[model samples]
Target: MGTPELALQVEPARWLGAPAPGGLALPPARAGRGTLYAPRGVYLDDRVVVVADSGNHRVLLWYGWPKADHQPADVVLGHTEFEAEGPGLLHLPTAVALVEGRLLVADAWHHRILVWDDLPEGSGQPPDRVIGQPDLRSTVPNAGGSPGPAGFYWPYGFTYVHGWFYVADTGNRRVLGWRGVPEGLRPADLVLGQPDAYSGAENRGRGVGADTFRWPHALVGDEMTLYVADAGNHRVLGFTPPPEQDRPADLVLGQEDFDRDFELPHVPQGPQRLRFPYGVALCRDYLAVADTANNRVLLFPGPPRRGVYLPAAHVIGQANFAESGENRWRAVGWDTLCWPYGVWGYQDLLAVADSGNNRVMIWRLRRS
Candidate 1:
């Protein structure tokens, strides 16, 4: 469930997969909350799914929702505070995905990546393929130095894009890549910030500010563009296809035009601005921003029909939800939403990683 232990360090995400109107039995009032803090990113397909329960020091696999919470997760990928097992376990599992028929985990705290072929089969807990630390050490781990394919440091976010894997190595201040992924999980081919950073101070050595990202947190890529929640930059940076060396971001949001500072906060006209944006995704053409600090999910409408060109339209929760301050949880029309950190597009429904309030919130998105 959503525990204060994890919250203080990682901010847990709520399981928003809803129960049938009058069907599934509700768990004990206390058991339904969430077990994440800064529960950052999520991914799903068919009957299998994964979550980066970051602060919790684990990754949870479900046989899909509705059936998810009720059943014990099909897999537990790390060493939880209370549970003991696995490949010495994970320090902070920030993101997860099933890639090329294999499981992928951004074992953030351990400074590496872990892979599994089955949900909870072989080894029961030990990862078959690991990328970060070679041995096991619990307290504040280190990557030694330059991550040579099998290494990473505070790799905060991850996703499988076009058979390749892209990682936001937060502590290292870079977006490291495993071109052809699952196949090339070693040695990053592309690096955004610096590489395999070992010290906190050195993280920003590359440069801080809008132009050069500091802590590039989460990522989401579409057919034509790649969107990054460039946390330190205080803006979302985008790049058109044909991404190349130092390929510039095509657009910026949260703050006014790039390179220029926003007179106010990043959340346009809202109660709180985004202090840290942890996750992002493209639902059709709409862009979803999990404005974590502000405790809200922001949406920018997708492009119009081929001929129509209505550019730059934004939408938060319900219009009635006040756009100011920290009361987003109690906003008139909101009814729900708390420290929401990550999001993914699911057909008509949007699966949200509602980190703080302790539950995933799925809303049926609509355009009018």
Candidate 2:
């Protein structure tokens, strides 16, 4: 049989930020206006939309689902005023999610994660807690490069799964886990890609391997499975029942094997490979990967089994799996994407953080 293809519903039905596509600019961060720049992370549900407005050093929260284009946000974090990008502010906020009524943000460049316990009552409120550093004012990696259990350098993204908090500590080239929300400089409950918690080595100090990682950027999974976007390695690694310690992934995507780090030679470059796959979302039988550098999203009608190089069943943002050019050699539009970094799927809605274009595109999946 031939590869499956998905039919999206009538182009992108809605966008959350920026009226038009534009490059990075430092303007007064405003809601429902053309102010977002290089937005890298986004999460939404039936009631709320949260964006890691990275370029502005802040996070924007829209309490209700946006009914129209460019809807104003209900809350903002990291600045007392929209124009300020000062100390104690979010430095390159790259991830955002709600955990137990609290808002968590991966403040990437600051080398820490910030948490708002009660989801900020209004714009510019301070965070209730901090992780990876002694306090909110400190931006040091592992607190002056000490490299211990709590030190993190460039933590890009995270996910809460099976009652554990997992962080893709990108700079450290590992993923850290905690049984609960971390408070201050505490040791992680589990560590992956390093010999021990104190060691920060690229690919676990052994170079490339199925069990090692280089720039593991994003994570999403559940109790039965785990997926990590190992960006630098140019593959997505999957683990069954979630590994508790350093172990090899059972499934590998975008490469011929887990030991292979380079993209396979496909004359037209197809769905069986990936180029800097940055974001992933899986719900039930559905899976979506933001093949970032290739400028498209790959969709699988069902999750691939362990130890198999199953090709993606469908392609989004491009006409087919064979073409990998930015925006499929077309202008940036609702039907096209450029360097999308984060994606989330729930029910029938799929949201993509189209980073290069600085917008969030929402699509309704159609099975036919």
Candidate 3:
């Protein structure tokens, strides 16, 4: 079947964290609902929006989608107040998600994931449970020892789908999964990229292949497939039936084959190649990938076929597929992006964590 055609607004419909007009020369890094600093992750749904303001070490939550640009968040996590800064309960949070109405945040520097049984209604609400550490106060990587299923080293991204939960244990060079919401520091039921839970070698200390990964950073999937952005390898891998154990991916994107991880020249390469792709999301009939190094996002038709060297059907954050410069190497504008780090998509809205731009841009998507 031919790929479905998709269209996106050249400019964002709404945005957050941009400086006020003529306010500052650079994007502000202050601690406030309307401000952000190098946000690396975002989660968007029909009614809510969440941003991992990574540089500020907090997560901002809007109870409802912001109706205007620079709308202040209604709640904040990881800090005591919107005006406060520095690490409090979170340390460089890199990702956020909502699972069955519960909140999950990847507190990357803390080497853990925090879960809230219920969504917080106000700022400073604490997580109900913790993962990857023995307690909330412990921040050691892999519990201060070798890699293991019960501990994590910079768990940067995660997703929950089909009653299963998965974490991109980035620092460990692995991905971990549980059958359900883990209650404590329980060992992961499945491990990928590495051979086993105790192994943390890059590409398993060998050449890159279908089963190895240098940096497994982000994940998104549906009931039948799971897609992972192996950033360090400069590709994305798709697993069918969401493997229950170590297995080679069934599909590869951004390269000619699984073994070749070479990046194309920095010029306007077509959509078949990727460089440091850090995020992936399934937006209805399309799969959106944050091609981080290219400063753009690629949209592939959904139900990604089992193959290598797949090409994207469309591109975002740039004027066309033949462009790959930050803000197109021009002045920042409503449609430009720089080093976008994360993406989350709902039915018709696509949210991008435009990290280098220090803002989240929400674009309207339409099918043709």
Candidate 4:
């Protein structure tokens, strides 16, 4: 199919990045500059919590799940300044996950992970424990002079599955696993992707094939398997707990091979491919891929195939937004999407991080 022409109209519902006082903003719907690069994941709530990593170098917290509704996360994490810092300070946080009763943050650029134990606190004030970059720093400005597990290099997404914590080390171009640190501090238990780098200047990006990754942005995992949003490579890599104890992705999804294409990377299949897939989530038997480049969400029925890419069992985006890549992905309802960078399913709500468009869209996800 060729690129679809966009028919939907673009409208501004609200403004963000306003000088919110007391972490609150209402009335006069403040306008955001523009969602050009709002890299964020979803919060576990009926409310759509966004890590609008505004240009301010701070995560802009907004809450409003059903769209028509309006409310914002009463809390904010990171420094009030437009610069990244240590401890409570965050820099370009791309992913946020709720682990146990606390919040887990992948403070990208700062090269570290922060655990906020103060549940429901207005903002992530002083995390109970800070991992990566013992000095506590963001991804940018590596001037902190820290080491790898010693510090993170652009950790993008975060997820706590089964009994472990996973981080998408974007700069390093790999995923790091750690035993879920309930107390004290957990160390990196395993490293996925090019675990070995020749030097500090090289990104560890190696795998069986295309699924190895280019710039890993987000990830999702359950009890037994791990799924990766190999953003730069435009594919999803899957793997089981390694028997060799090395995090080698055993399966693949999206395209047929690593060669860049608007399609998902995998081996050439009878028919199937993805384009710039950014976020991923598994709902029941369905594995959802936010094909970011195409501005659509493609759903696979049987999950990842080690070799071939599967045609979408369902799709949302221009297909639902008038068949145009103009506005990215948008699910005004279920089974629809656009330029969506994040997707998550829990309970009956499916939360999507509609990155470029500046809003997280929610939909009812059901099994047939």
Which numbered prediction scores highest in lDDT against the true structure?
3
Models sorted by TM-score, best on top: 3, 2, 1, 4
Residue 353's lDDT within candidate 4 is 68
Clashing pairs in 3: none
Off by over 4 Å in 4: 1-39, 46-56, 59-68, 79-88, 137-147, 182-187, 195-211, 241-244, 258-271, 305-307, 320-324, 328-338
Tens-digit lDDT track of model 1 for 243-352: 43444556666665555334345334552234567778776556777766565666655521111112234434433323533434343122345566777775545667
TM-score of each: 0.74, 0.91, 0.95, 0.73
| Residue-by-residue lDDT tens digits, candidate 2, 234-256 | 88888887877777888888888
lDDT, candidate 3, 1-368, per-residue tens = 12343443333688889653432244677888789999999998876799999989999998787878888889888887898878889999998988988889999999989989888888898888898888887899997788988899989899987888989999889889999978558999999888778899999999899999899999998889989999999999999978788899999999899998998867777878899999998876788999999999888876595899888887888877888998887756677788999899888888999998889998877644
lDDT of each: 0.55, 0.78, 0.86, 0.55
Model 4: residue 14 alpha-carbon error in angstroms: 14
Report the Cα RMSD per candidate: 8.3, 3.1, 2.3, 7.4
Model 4 Cα displacement at 276 (Å)?
A: 2.2
Task: Write model 4 residue lDDT over 130-171, tens digit each, in one string.
Answer: 766544433342225433443467777767778877777677
When 3 and 4 are scored with lDDT, the better candidate is 3
**Cand. 4 Cα-lDDT:** 0.55
Model 3: residues with Cα > 4 Å off, grouped in runs: 1-11, 20-25
Instruction: Give the lowest summed-lDDT range of ten residues in model 4.
Output: 20-29
> C-alpha displacement of 77 in model 2, angstroms?
1.4
